[model samples]
Structures are given as structure tokens and as C-alpha cells.
Target: MAKVLSLILGGGKGTRLYPLTQSRSKPAVPFGGKFRLVDIPISNCINSGFRQIYILTQFNSASLHTHINTTYKFDNFSKGFIEILAAEQTFEHDSWYEGTADAVRKNFQHYASLEPDYYLILSGDQLYKMDLESFLDEHIKNGADVSIASTPVTRRAANDLGIVKIDETGKIIEFHEKPGPDKDISDLKIPPSQSDGSDKEYLASMGIYIFNASAMEEGLDNKDSDFGKQIIPSMISTKNVHAYTYKGYWEDIGKISDFFDATLNLATPVPQFNLYDEENPIYTKQRDLPPSKINSCTINSSLATEGSIITDSYISNSVIGIRTIIDSGATLDGVYCMGADRYETLAEKEENRRRGIPNIGIGSGSIIKGAIIDKDVRIGSACRIGVDKMDRKDGSYENYHIIDGIIVIPKKTVIPDGTII
Candidate 1:
């Protein structure tokens, strides 16, 4: 295997996921409860046997930096380590990263010094499992100056991405970045041999590229800062740019809706993307906590991480993070809850309220439905959450009932006991 320098782009602001991305960068946002968004790409690289990696980050990078420092570790004796290349001002440039290509261009000198054979560029916010070795092998075999990972998307969806027109031999001919509705796909005129009958046969770039070191250097030096807007197009006429087709489960969780959907999908019985693939294991910082204890709790197809205590709680179809506690008679359905930070706060409050009682007596008789509760929440007994029809029309009421449903409780809220609906 040749020496490959992998660059994972982790700088995007992720504006669409406003509140979630507000605190952390897009790549650092929590995913599947335990893993961060950046973990997918880094894990893919490690699984693909690439060790020399650099993550380029900029906006709201604190959490991202912490994650990288704690999660990724490489042997010092070996020539492999994951490093963060944060945006810095040099003599020539005082501005922040202007675009994707600009970010790589600024860091070009660093990778150049390493003298790697190939430069692998990846976006950190995508959810996919891939063996990059196969892509690199194909690039070498085709003698490609640049190899772009491409996937076929529906015509309706093609307008949102950079679409490529390739020949039978996979040579990319025409490149369109988010083309308009009227632009005929036939005008690009993909060769008859390469054409599939479906009208939605357009190939979309996965924003992943493998470039010959020299080719990347030259392109970055000669073109405008943006890759999608300029460098990629410049290469089409002069370079041997090929498209490597990918047919698998892949999603770009750039928007809040997409992120929500992706997280929920993991709870499916057989999810589209499997993180537990033995052949290509996605690595993360593993916690050595004990298994979740479910005592008289009804759990249905939910992902529960370590150190969780569910007592008489009905949890179903949700992702529960570590160290979460659900006291007796607490019911939850389709709730994504994290219990790390809130445990201490809730414990302190409970202790104060208990005054040295044997039982802390927090979070009892609480019913939660279709909600996302962050860590460290203490719900006192008889709190009706996520239930409909709290009281009967005749003025009679159940002990726990949710009204208007889908209530999201942020971390560290204290619900007092005997709170009726």
C-alpha cells in the first residue's frame, strides 16, 4: 500500500441544524447517542488501513477538538497519527477558510511536506461505511489524476448535488453543480453504453475525492479557491478525472431533519447502515461501563448504551446514551435520552430533597412519550409526560397521562413530585 495522506473536512457551520450545531461544529454533533458525526469518516479511514490523517476544522471547534484528542490515538513510533489542522493566519493569507478547496489549499504545504503518494479528501458529516483501499486501487489502475466517488441519485434529488456525466470507461466528461430543472441530462450525452433507462440516472458526487499528490498540488495552485465551483471543473477538460460508482447506504446529515431521521433509523430492526459490520468496524472511544439494567421495563428495538438503569420504565424505539437513570414507574416511548451530565445534578438535588432518606424518590410515576431528554433530569413522582387526555371529560384523571405529546425536556430540569396534569 502506498503512503496516503487523508484530509477529513470538519469545518462546515451546519447552519441548517441550527440549535444542535450552535454549540458544536457539524462534525462534532452527537450521533446514534454515543458517537459524533466525525467518527464515521475517521473510523472509515482506520478500517481502510489509512493512518496518516488530518482533520481541518474552523467554526465552533471546541467540542470537535476535544473529541479528536480523546477518541483518536496512534502509536508515536509508527508513522501514523490523526492531527487537527485548524485555520491559522500565515504571511500570505489572513482570512479564514473561504471554501472547501481553499481549506485544503491552505493546508497543502503540510501534506506536501509529508510526501504522500495520494491525497484522500473526505467530508466529516456524511454517514457511510466504505473501504477506501478499493477506491485507491481503482484510481491507481485507471491512472486517474483525480478520482471522485459518485453515487446515482434520483433526478428529483440530483438538483441538490454536483452531478457528473461519465463515459462507459468511467471517464467524467461533464460536471454540473446543482443544475437547474430545464437542463436536459441527455445534453451532457452520456454514451449509450453507459446510459441506464431510468430518467433519474444522474450520478451525484459524494464530495469525496482522491487526488494524485502532484495533481492536487498543481490544481490547488492554479485554480480559484473553491473545489466544487472551480477546481473540479478545471480538471474536467485537462485531467484524467474518473468517477467511481458507489451503491450503498450513504447519507449527508447536514440538516436537522436529516440528522433526526438518521438517528431514528438506527433503531430499526435491520438498519440500512450497519455500524457493527465485523469486516469494517467503526472505531470510537469505548466506555467500560456495565450493561443496562432493565427491571420490569419494556424495551422495544431501542439502542441502550452502558450504565443505564431503567426501573419499571417503558422504553421503546429510542437511543439512550450512557449512565441514564429512569426511576421506578417512569414510562418512555420513542425517546432519545442522554444521562451523563444530568446524573450529578439530579443526584445532588435528590439528596437535598431526601434529607438522608433511604430512597432518593426522584423520577417516579413519570410518563414520557416521543421526546428527546438530555442528561441530568430529575422528574418527581406523578409527572404526566407525552400522554394524551390527561383527565377524563367527567373530571376524573389517570395518575400519568400525556397531553399534546412530543415534549422535549432539555438537560437538568427538576420536576417536583405530585405534579398532576
Candidate 2:
């Protein structure tokens, strides 16, 4: 077996995700109910027998560092390990990562020392379950210097992605990045024979790639900052790059609207992305919290994690996370309550009450709909979140702001009594 190093790109500031990425990197952003976005890639690597993994990120990585430290503790006898490579001022490089390719270029020295046969590069913010060993096997079979993981996508979706054209032999011969709708990209559409039964018109790069170690080193020697924008285009003619088709659920939750929709989808009876597949389950920090307690709460199509207490609440189409406490008469719809880091002690709860402060979770009679309540948030009584339902984007209102018509309450914020968004 060839030793492969899996490099996950924990994307930059995640400006599109805004307030959610306000305090954490895109990979560190919470997903589903309990797990962070980083967990998806890490779990996939572990399941695929790729343990020598490295996450590269530069912006707001404090929470990412903490999560990795506290969660991924490898046994002394095991060779499997995951590590973080944050961008720093090294002797060779002074500035931060300009783009994906530049980030890998700066961190090359670290992974190169491992002398892996192949490099498996992945995006950190996508939601998917993949057997990476299969990807590696295809790369070996094709004898490709670079093999990109691709998925069939509709023309509409392909317009926003890096599209590819593969020949009958599955060798990628052409590449186009985010081709404008006005431009003609008929040459980049998937060949009829390879289209199989899928209605998709084009093969879109899933942002996953397998690179021969030497090829990667040579590819990054240029001043190009991004892979899709520069490196891949430059490699198409010189390198034997191939495309491996993937048929599964894959979503890049980069924008706030995408994140919001993806979160709420988990509340459905059968989500597009399943989180309960025991064979390839998503891994995360497992706190020993008791199972959720429902006190006459009416919940429909919702997922409540362990250590939650819902009392007389009507929760529908929501994802309730760990250690979440929803008081009586709270009506929750399309809400994502990312639970607290830890439950406040009795003493701490008493002190808050004495100081007339709201408890560490949702309070009584609160109507929370189309909202995301981040960790350790204190929602006072009768708070009407997403109450305004305005489509216009505006400045923050008491830290409870609207992004693309969804109410986003930043992490650790306090929503006072009778507050309305």
C-alpha cells in the first residue's frame, strides 16, 4: 500500500458564511447538529484508511485547533494521526496564503518530508461520504500524474463550478472554471457514454484530487495562487490528468444560504445527506452527555442530539444540538440550535438568575423560526427571532442580524426578553 497524505483545505475567512465564520474558520463552522464542517473530511479519511492527514488554514482557526486537540487523540502504538498546518511567517515565506495552491506551496516542506507516494487533496467545507481508497485506486489504474474527483452536474450547477471534458479513455483533455452563462462550454460537457443514467450535462470538479508527489511539487513551483484558476489549466496540456466520476450526495456549503438550507435539510425525514450511516458515520468530539429529555414537547421532523431538554415546545423541521434547553411554549421551526460547550453549573445558573440574566439557552414563549442560534446563546422570554421576515439586507440589529433573509445569531450572544428581529 502506498503511503498517502491527505491534505484538507480549511478555506480562508469564509466571507460568504459571515457571522457563522465570524469567530471560526469555515472548517470549524458547526454542521448538522453537533459536528463541525471539518469532521466530514476527517471522518472520510479515517474510514478510507488514510490517517496521515493534514489540515491547512490561516484565518480564525482557534476553534479548529482546539477541536482537533481535544478530539483526535491517537494511541501511542498507532501510526495514524491528523495534524494542523496553520499559515505562518516562515523563513521561506512571509505573507499568508494567497489561495489554495499558494497555501499548499508554502506548506509543501512539511508534507514532502513524509515522502508519501501520492497526495490526496480535499476541500474542508463540502458535505459528502466518499471512500478515498477508491479514488487512489483509480489514480493508480489510470497511471495518472493527477486525477481529479468529478461529479455529474446540471448545466446550471456546472456554470458555477470548474467543469471538465474527458475523452473516451477518461483522460481529462479540457478544463473550464466557472464558465460564464453567456459563454458556450459544449465541449466541456460529459461524453454521452460516460453520462450513464444521470441527467447531468457536465462533469464538475468536486475539488478533490490525487496528485503524484513529484507532479504536485512541480505544479506548485509557479507564482499561480489557485489550483482551479491557474495550476489545473496549466497542467491540462503537460500532465496526464484524469477524471474519476463520483455518483453521490455532495454539497459545498460555502455561502450562508447554502449553509442555512443544508442545516434545515437535516431535519427532513430523508435528508439529501444522511448523517446516520453507521458504517461510514461522521466523527466528532463525543462529550458524555445524557440523552435528550422531552417534556411534552411536540416535535415533528427534527433531530435532537444528546443532553437536550425540551419542555412543552413545538419544534418542527429543526436540528437541536447537545446540551440545549428549550423552555416551555417555545415554537421552533427551521431552527438550528448549536448547543453549548458545556452546561452551566447550578451555581452559575443561580448567579445568572440573581443578576436577571437569561439562561444559557432558549427561554419561554420564544418563537424561533428560520434562525440559527449559535453555541452558548441566551434567549430571553418571548423573543421573536426571524420575526421581521424582511428580504432586504441591512446592518446588524443588536447583534441579531439578517443575511439573505435568514436570522443569524452569532455565537455566545444574548437575546434579551421580548426581543424581535
Candidate 3:
């Protein structure tokens, strides 16, 4: 059996996912009520038998480190290990990771000790369940130096992702990184023979790759900062680069709008990304909390995770995360309430009242629509958010923000009574 070292790029500043990434790293950001964003790739790696895994993170990694240390613990005899390789200022290199390739290149000294046969590169903020054994098999079967996972996507999505043009033999010929709407990428359309009768016109790189040991070392020999922008394009001409077409559900939860939509979509009867798969389950840090308790609440097409208390509320098309507390007469629609980290004690509630602030969670008679209430927010009674003000400008405010026309309440913010946003 060939040894494959999996490297998950935990992303750069994550400016696109700001506010949420304000206190925590992108990978550490909570998702789908219970699990974090990083859990998707880590679960996929473990399920695919890729035992030795390393996550490369640069910014705001404290929570990520704590979560990893608590959740994934191997037995004393097992060789499997999941570790975080944080960027550090060494004597030789004094700067933080400049880009994706730079992050990996700098960590070469650490991972090189493992001396694996192949390197499996993955993006941290993507949602998908892939059988990487099959991916590695394709790379070995093609006898290619590097294999990039590609998914069929339309022109609208092709603009934001790395577009690849492959020949009939699955050899990648050209690569384009985020060729915006103005670019003429007609030549990059998927070949009819490889289209598999799909309406998607282009094949976009999933930022997932399998590189032979020598090919990776050679590809990173230069000062190329990014894999898609610099290394992959350069290697296509000199190396045996192939494309592995993957026809499955894949979502890049990078932008605020993308994150919001992808999350609420899971509140439906059937989501595009399945979290209830029996065999390939997504893992996370298990909090041994009690079951959610609802009191005469009419919940329709919503996912209320563990340890929530809802009373006389009308929730529709929403995701109420763990440890949530919704007071009586509250109506939540198309909302993603991330829930509190810890339940506020009675003393804490008294302190909040003393400070003239609401307790942690939704107060009575509050109506929130198309909004994201972050963790540990104290929303007072009779508060209306995103319901009345549909055309709110895109900017930050005292307690919340409106980005892409969606209201976002940052972590631990406080909104007083009778407030309307």
C-alpha cells in the first residue's frame, strides 16, 4: 500500500467570511448547527483511510487548535494522527504564509520527514464527501505525476473557480484562475466526449489534488505563491497532469452569501449535501448535551440541533444550532442561529439584567427573518431584524451588519429591547 500524506489548507485571512472569522479561523467557524467547517475535510480524510493528516492554518487558530486536540484522539497503539501545522516565524523564514502554495512549501520541512509516496491536497472550507481511495486509484491508474479533481460547473460558477481544459485523454492542457465575466474562456469548455451529458459547460478545479512525491517537490521548487495561479499552470506543460472529473455534490462555503444559503438549504426535506449518511458520517467534537426541548413550537423544514429550548415559536426554513434558547412568541424564518457556546447560568442572567442587557439568546416577541444570529448574542424582547428593513445598506453597525443584504449578528453582541433593524 502506498503512503499518502493529506494536507488541508486552512485558508488565508478568510476576509470573505469576515465577522464570523473575526474571532475564529475559517475552519473553526461553526456550521450546520453542530459541526465546524473544518470537520468536512477531516471526516472525509479519515473515512478515506488517509490516517496521517495535517491542517495548515495561519490566522486565528486558537479555537481550531483546541477543537482538534479535544475531538480527534487516536489510541496509544495507532499510527493515525491528525495535527495542525501552524505558520511560525522560523530563523530561516520570518514571514507568515503568503499564499496556498507558500503555506505548503514552508511546511515541506515538517511533512518531508514522513516521506510519503503521494501528497493529497485539500481545501478546508469546502463541503463534500469523497471516497479518496477512488481518487488515488485514478491517479495511479493513469500513471500521472499529478491529478486534479474537477467538477462540472456552469459559467456563473466558473468565474470564481479555477477552470481547466482537458483533452480526450483527460490530460489537462490549460488552466485559468478566476477568469471573471470579461474573460473569453470559450476554449475552456468541457470537451463533449468527457461531458457525460451534463448541462455544465466548464470543468472547474475543486482545489483537490494528488501529487506524486517527486512531482510535488519539483512543482514547489519555485517561489510560486499559489497552486492554482502559479504552480498548476506551470506544471501542465512539463509534467503529466491529469483531471479527475467528479460528479457529486460540492459546495465552497467561502463567501457570506454562499455560507448563508448553503446552511439554510440544509433545513429542507432533503439537502444537496447529506449529513445523515450512515457509512460516511461527518465527525465533530461531541458535546454530551441533552436533547432539544420544544414547547408548542411549530417548526417546518427546520433543523434544530441538540440542547435547544424553543417555546411557542414559529420556525420555518431555519437551522437552530446547539444550546439555543428562544423565548415565547418568537418567529424565526430563513435564519441560521448559531446558538450559544455555554448556557448562561442564573447568576449570569442576573448580571445581564443588572447591566441593562438581555440574556444570551432570543428574547420574547422577536421576529427575525433572513438573518444569522451568531453565538452568545443577547437579543432583547420585541426586536425585529431583517424583517422590516429589507433594503438595509451593506455595512457594519453597533450590534449587527448587513452584508449582501443579509443581516449578520456577530458573536456576543447585545441588542436592547424594542430594537428594529
Candidate 4:
């Protein structure tokens, strides 16, 4: 196996995921409660036996920097290591990276110094498990100058991505960046005559590419900007560009809806993304905390990490991160709570607000449901939360009452004793 130089692009201004991306970069968004989004690709690289890696970042990358330093560490004796390349200004180039290709172009001299054989370019915001060793082996066997990982996508979804056309020999002949109407799909290469008459519109690039060192260098030098729009299309005519078929669970978390959908999917009974593969473990910073202590709680299909304490609460289908505390008489469904401090503030505010008697009364009859609570919440005894009128119609008032749809209780609000909220 050749020593591959991996460049993970982490510098996207995540405007779609506002508020969450407001504080950190998209790659640094908290995922599965505990891990960050960048952990997926970095861990994939480590598990795939490729240790020489560099992460490139631009916007609000402090959290991303801290995560990489705290989570991934390599021995000095080993050749395997990870480096973070933040944007720097030089006399010739004083501006931040404009596009994917420009980011690489700026770092070309740095990469050239390393003397690597192949360059593996990857996006940091995608979610999937890939063994690059297999992809690289296929690239070598095909004698391809550039090999891109591709998957079958529906025609409707193809418009969002750079669509490619490949011929019978598995050679990519044309590349279209977000095709427009009247663009001939037929001219877009398809395999030889198929058994079915249906249009064989298969194989869209996964935005993952393996480039020969020389090809990458040439493309970086020739193109002014934009890898997908300019450089890739230019190389298609001259180089042996090929598509490597990939069949796996992959997603591009580009927007808030996409991020939300991906997070919610992890709560399923049998999630599509498996993080428990011991052979290819998703490594993260290990917080030294005790296992979650659940006492008399009704929890169903939820993921609770270390240092969680759930007592007399009803929780279902949620991801609870480290050091979270769910008090007795609380009900939660479909929520993602990260960190303890934020949870505590919300709990206190709700406890005080529900009492109506201000600081002197307890919220004994409160109920809560379908809400995300952050850490360190101090709830008064007997608060009613998330309980519905229908639940009370049966003459059973054991559950807390729900106030409205999507109400979040900030952490650390105080409540008095013996009040029905």
C-alpha cells in the first residue's frame, strides 16, 4: 500500500445550520450527543490504517481545534499523525480560501514538502464509513489518474450534486456541476445495452476522490479556483478518470433539515449508522465519568452515555450526552441533551415558572414531553410536565402536563415546594 496523504476539508461556513453553527464550525457540531461531526472522518481514517492526515479549517475553528487535540493523539516514533492547517495570509495570497481547490492550492507547497505518493481529498461534513485502503487499491489496479467514489442516486437528487457520465469501460467521460434543463442525459455516458429498457441513470460522485500525486499537482497549478466546476471537468478529457462504485450508508449534512434527520435516525432501534463496530471504532475524547445510573426510570430506545443519572423519569428515543442528569418525575421523548450546565439552567427556570407562586412553592404536578433539556437542572418536587388533557381524562394524574409544542427549559432556575404547575 502506498503512503497516502489525506486532506480533510473542514472549512465550510455552515449558514444552513444557524445557531448551532453560530458557535462552531459545521464539522464541530455536536453529534450523537457526545461526539462531534469531524470525529467520523478522522476516526474512519485512523481505523482504515491511514495515519498521515491533515485537517483544513477556516470559520470559527476553535472548537474543532480543541476536539482534534483532545481526541486524536499519535506517538512520535510512528509515522502516523494528524495536523490542522488553519488559513494563513502571505504577501502573494492575503485572503482566506475561496473554494475547495483554492484551499488545496494555498497548501500545495506544504503538501509537496511531505513527499507523499497519493492524495485523498475528503469533505469533513459527510457521514459514512469507508475503508480507503480498498478504494486506493482499486485506483491502483485500474491505473486511473483520478478515482472518485460514486453511488447511485435518484434523478431528482442528482441535480444537487456534480453528476457524471461513465461509459462501458467504467471511464468517466463528462462531468456536469448541477445540470440545467436541456442538458442531454443521454449524452451523459451509460453502461452498454442493459437488459431493462429503463434509463440507466446510475453512479453520482460521492465528493470523495483519490488523485495521483502528479495529476493533483497539475490540477492545482492549472486551475484558478473551484475543484468540481473547473479542475475535475478539465482533467476528464485528458486523464484516466474513473468511478469506484460504493454501496454504503452515506449522507451530506449540508442543511439544518439534513442535520436534524441524521440525528433523529440515530435513535432508531437498529440505526443505519453503526458506531459499535469494534474493528472500526469511532474514536473520541474519553471523558472519565461513571456509567449512567437509572433508578426506577422508564427508558425505551434511548442512548445514554457515561455520567448520566435518570431517576423516576420516562425517556424514549433520545441521545443523552455525558454528565447529564434527568430527575425523577420528568418525561422526555425525542430529545437530544448535551452538557450538564445548559440542562441545569432550563430545569430551574421551568420549575420556577410552573409554580406560579414564584420561589416559595413546589411544582408537584408538572409534566414534560418532546423537549430537549441541557445539563444541571434543579427541579422542585412534584412538578407536572408534558402531561396531556387526554392523559388526565382517564382520571390518572401520574404523568406531568405538557404546556405547548417545543418548549425548551433552560438550566439553573429555582422553584419553591408544593405547587401544581
Best by TM-score: 3
Clashing pairs in 1: 342-376, 387-402, 387-403, 388-402
Please give, for residues 162-270, the per-residue lDDT of candidate 2 as tens digits.
9999998899999999996888887777777787766688999999999999999999988999998899989999999999999999998868889988988988888
TM-score for candidate 1, residues paired by index:
0.86
The global Cα lDDT (0 to 1) of model 1 is 0.78
Summing lDDT over every window of 10 consecutive residues in candidate 1, give the lowest-scoring window.
Answer: 394-403
Give the Cα RMSD of candidate 2: 1.5
lDDT of 3: 0.93
Clashing pairs in 3: none
Each model's total of backbone clashes: 4, 0, 0, 47
lDDT (CA) for every model shown? Answer: 0.78, 0.90, 0.93, 0.73
> 149, model 1: CA deviation in Å?
0.5
Query: By TM-score, how accurate is candidate 2?
Result: 0.96
lDDT string, candidate 1, 1-421, tens digits:
6999999998878876555565688898777877888999999999888999999999999989998998888887878899999999999789999889999999876777889999999999999988899999999999999999988777777767888888889999889998867777655544567666666477888999999988998889853877777999899999999998787888977565566667767988999889678988777776777888878878888888777877887777788777777788777667777566323556766776676321222377777666556445556677765566653332112322122333444445555665543
In candidate 3, what residue range of length 10 has the lowest lDDT sum? 383-392
Model 4: per-residue Cα lDDT over 103-129, one tens digit each: 988887677888889999998888999
Candidate 3 lDDT over 342-367, as tens digits, reads: 99899988998898999989999999
Clashes of 4: 47
